[model samples]
Target chain A: MTTWMRLMSNDGRIVFGRVENSYLHEYESLHAPVPTGAVLSLRTLTPVAPCAPGKVVALWNNFHALAAKLEKPVPEHPLFLLKPAESVIGSQQPIRRPAHYAGKIVFEGELGIVIGKRCSNASLDEAEAAIFGYTIVNDVTAAGLLNENPHFPQWCRAKGFDTFCCIGPAIVSGFDWRSARVVTKLDGVERQNYPLDDMVFTPAQQVSLISRDMTLEPGDVIACGTSLGVGSIGDGATVEVSIDGIGALVNTLAVSSGEAEAAAAVEGAA
Target chain B: MTTWMRLMSNDGRIVFGRVENSYLHEYESLHAPVPTGAVLSLRTLTPVAPCAPGKVVALWNNFHALAAKLEKPVPEHPLFLLKPAESVIGSQQPIRRPAHYAGKIVFEGELGIVIGKRCSNASLDEAEAAIFGYTIVNDVTAAGLLNENPHFPQWCRAKGFDTFCCIGPAIVSGFDWRSARVVTKLDGVERQNYPLDDMVFTPAQQVSLISRDMTLEPGDVIACGTSLGVGSIGDGATVEVSIDGIGALVNTLAVSSGEAEAAAAVEGAA
Candidate 1:
């Protein structure tokens, strides 16, 4: 398995490269591995989200373990949601809570399939080939927003805020994801630990089925739905979503004081 | 009301301009009007979607009339869903049916709020200032996908196909939306006729509240949810969504042959 990452180097140059033994071997492109002969220490660079996605298509209940645990029937097709591209953040970015929303925020750890090619109406084999790599995703949600009104669940609003989606560490290719497991930790305490083998739909099947619904372009991400052990996070708590082969994505949660104050001032004026 | 539109001129150039008296006055940017001294006949240009949005935040039950009609309670907050940017299409673009989905597709005609600036945690007045203009939206949905699996409603999948969202004709600024009405017709037969004043939340309130949920960027669209008379569209049927101030957005629905054949072949092979 090879690890790919986008990072800002010591010289302030943003580059895409491969990580090997804590050193980065800069590459010209992810599609064609033409080495740029620029090797730098990984510690000398600041990591960013591996790829800039145009859109993130996230799943809701594509896990067998979660379905059985919830006593819900397995879905015939993937139940998915769209997380706006603006919500995306890198590994170390803080998950800023909405100023107007004071509610329980939860972290969902799942594997993200990064599309490498423009895929439309692709067959199973073709879909398999279209997958470039996998990365860790922290699909943070304002849990209280889901049942606040009861008339309708605000899936997009509950999850679409800026910095709600924390993804990265690195995108790893050629990894055997079937054996991988998602282990989530909050404040250094283990919470969710689920196996990828318990998925209702395989990665290839998901790619093929979803591609039929919409075109999946290069850098587009498909977040495989999370399993059980999902729980809430308090302000100032550090959450880390880890996968064995992919690596760990760590982010801190906090309420924005400046924005909150600005909102309150506006409210008072009105 | 001031109308803004993007059109392809007879000289084979796509230009963003002000639409006045069946003539196009070309402008460099949407924020400021810097006339390029190029005025072309409106008939010489093909009209496109008014603005290029990064994301379209669409509402579900923000209409009082429809909620009351459906026997549902009014939402405390705007219950919204996201339509991926890839789903967006200009007026007159055909709504291509998903190859794998052989189901009912319905159209929800509503007013679209276009954002002018990057706004978050804005007050009512700030939100009002952030609104650039209004347009018409045909929020098309794959109706059958909603309840095919009873566990979770596939809102994103139901509406996330390419060309599912038809928006445009023009973005009319400084329009009196309170007296405005959305009139939808299928095959030239009137179907839905609803008043914008029947909305649970006003445009400014929706902007203020939704901005608190997430940052509304320039050119971002928030579809003010639809009212009653949402129904299905037959294959090869022409559907139109019209607002009184903004022009009508018309599109045709058709089944995709090549993609469907490819999917069927894969199914047969499996």
Candidate 2:
């Protein structure tokens, strides 16, 4: 007999899905290697950042559409960036941009790859071993700094605020790439949707390409570029990013914790 | 009594004043703090790097003169950066720019601060406990991609290659910054020479500023800014960055290791 955890019902029987009017850890099971006819529940949580001590490496735009928008050549290699770990929030947390930012907050829906091991000049085969799991990340942005400083040598300060990067739930290992689907929903309407395999560089290739220049340590998460349907999102909009096999991550819009607490109090009243 | 090390003659007698050229280790001591009024000599081959391994954090133009050269704002707060550790080289090496690099090498002389303790969100006084000592670094950079891209974000490919970052000697705990100085010489031409106290932010202040946003780990190195009289050197030139109290760090200029090796062979023949 195998032991699996599931949410419970009022009568004490195990519940296979979400419980009504409460927070209960609900889950389903599946075969490791599925046949074409096998069906699995889409209840897995959105992937959160796995790094505890590792630096957050963010890529600008390794996508074809974004490249076309900028009229720049798609890079032969991934352009790397550093976002200090201080900027991360959980999966269901509100994406916050303080009044000081005053810039538009844009969302870039990306497939986040979590590193499982320490690596330097790693090979493609070695990179596979280092991948702990995968998740979806809404790579939030301030969206106006690029235009403000055309001559700046680096952009760490502009992109590095306390809540610039958000990730969550747990990591899902054994993530297969073929036919994976990703969708972004805004206020209950689907805004962007695309296939995971549409990327110019695959996850394995990104790892191999990046390790040539920088050494990747354990718990490092690399966010592959978002697909088409990416546009700016203003304040006060609920943004949910979902993957086919993985569950949906719905986070509301709020400027600060004060606003979030006020909204929570209103929900309790109703 | 404490047993200390000093450079010794081939016959085992202690060598004084000048370090025997033949006895210098093959590896370079790229960036290391110099003890005030002490001649630094390696008694044992200890590997030294410009910054510690947690991440090579650099502050862009913590001094005003550098911000003007790049035509950037003297940042309201300290500007921080990550230079890949792979770029490090020892003192005996020359800064290398290969044919592949194609005239992309630039030099930045910074006072290197070595962290001895783990600290995060540290206050001004807390920063003092985190610092182990200081060193000097010639932050050698590759400019083509960085100049071509929106911002050269890849310090690994641009500045993190082998031998690109240099340091030296051993760590010395105490030095009065009020009277400290830094000097840079290219082909012995003396391009930059300035007092360390002339920095826009002090070493303790830089550490304190970073800790407010980051949890600095041990072995993490910080490169404080270079002074005025900065310029480029490559193809073939000897570059030296020296700090008063710290020993002189000398490296010949080529674009990279292959070029450095070829230059070395040519110099060997002469």
Candidate 3:
């Protein structure tokens, strides 16, 4: 198994690298990475999301445990929504509260499947082959915005604010997700502990089924929806989503501020 | 007023140009385009979508006539969904039927707001300044897939098929949209004729309000939702979405084929 990460050097150069013990061996690019043989300490580099996905195809009610609890039947196909690229943020980034929304903000810990090849209407084999690696995703949402109007469910707007989709630490290739478990902690207290084997649709099945609806491109992410433990996070509270094979992704909710000032803060950080 | 278009030359060179009467004046780029002094006949170039957007922020029930007809209240804020970039197709491109879904495909003729400046939580004045131009759009949908499940509404999936979001002909700058009308023709028969002035939210209001939800990047598109007549299209039927200032965007629905084969054909064309 190999682990890959994207990071910024102290000089502000973005580079992809293969993670080793305590160092990152640099690479030229993520698609066809070539080793530069220059190793850097992990402590000296600032980590970013492993990949820049064009869109994040996130599933809903895909876990058997979550479905049973919510009284929802197992869906025949993957029920999903598209999160915009603007919602993405790296681990250790702040999950800012939207300026206009003063409602509760929730965090869902999920396993993200990273696409390595462009695919549409792919077969089971092709779908499995298209799977590049796996990463951790904190699908943060403005809980109140969803179902605010009885006529329409605002899925995209509720979950698509800046820094709402947190992904990182590393993308692990050939990780055994079937035997792994996702553990989420809020303020260092365990809130969610679920097994990945309980997923109704496997990662390959998700890719194959969803490809029939829309094309999945290279670097596009499919967040395999969360299970069991989803709860609200208060301002300045820290949330960490971790998997055994993949590393932990930690982020803190920023203090609520006016909409314009919050937007400017995020832009300034970008 | 100026009109801009992106096209493929006979030699397969992609260029952005200013549209004149039956000719194109080449430019260096879409953002900060500098005239290249190369003129080409319109007949020699193949037109593509005016701009490649990272995400298409689409509004729902934003038209006053549509809400009044359906007996739904005018939403306080823009009720919207995100259309993936993969779903975008330029004018003249074929709208292929999804392989897995054998259902009614509907066409929605609407106006599109193209953003030139990056903005989030912008003021109304800032929003107006950020608007780059306007174009015509056919927000196509798989009518049956929507509300397929009683619990979850598949807005993104039903409306996000490959080639579902058809845009362009040209992006018109400084066009008078308030006095214009969106006229949609189905196989030479007029089906929709809605005045742009009936919109519940103006273009600037849309930009400013949506900016609070997520950042609008340059080339990002906000498809103003359709009104009045939205109907299904049969195989090989032509659909044209036209505005007075923005030229007509014409497309044809391709005959249904196997999902894998259809996807392969699209990839082959790409």
- Name the top TM-score candidate: 3
Tell me the docking grade of candidate 1.
Answer: medium
Ranked candidates, highest lDDT first: 3, 1, 2
lDDT of 2 by residue, B1-270 (tens): 111112334555432222344243222222232333444445444433433455677776777666677676666556666765555666776665543456557777778887867776677788987887776788877766564555345544576655677875434457565587778888888888877766778888888877654557666778887768767776777888887766677877754566668789999999
Tell me the lDDT of model 2 at A5: 18
Q: What is the lDDT of residue B177 in candidate 2?
A: 57
| Per-model CA lDDT versus the true structure | 0.88, 0.63, 0.93
Which 10-residue span in candidate 1 chain A carries the lowest summed lDDT?
A254-263
lDDT of each residue in B1-270, candidate 1, tens digit only: 799998876777778888889898998867665899988888888887788887888888878888888899888788888887888998988899887787899999999999988899899999999999999999999998877877677788888898988899899999999998999999999999999999999999999998888888888999998999999999889999998878899999965786567779999999
Which candidate, 1 or 3, would have the higher TM-score against the true structure?
3
Give the residue spans of candidate 3 off by over 4 A.
Answer: A36-38, A257-270, B258-270
Candidate 1 residue spans exceeding 4 A from truth: A9-14, A21-44, A255-270, B9-13, B31-44, B258-270
- DockQ, all models: 0.65, 0.17, 0.80
1 against 2, candidate with superior DockQ? 1
Model 3 chain B: lowest-lDDT 10 consecutive positions: B254-263
Give the distance in Å from residue B143's predicted Cα in candidate 3 to where it truly belongs: 0.8
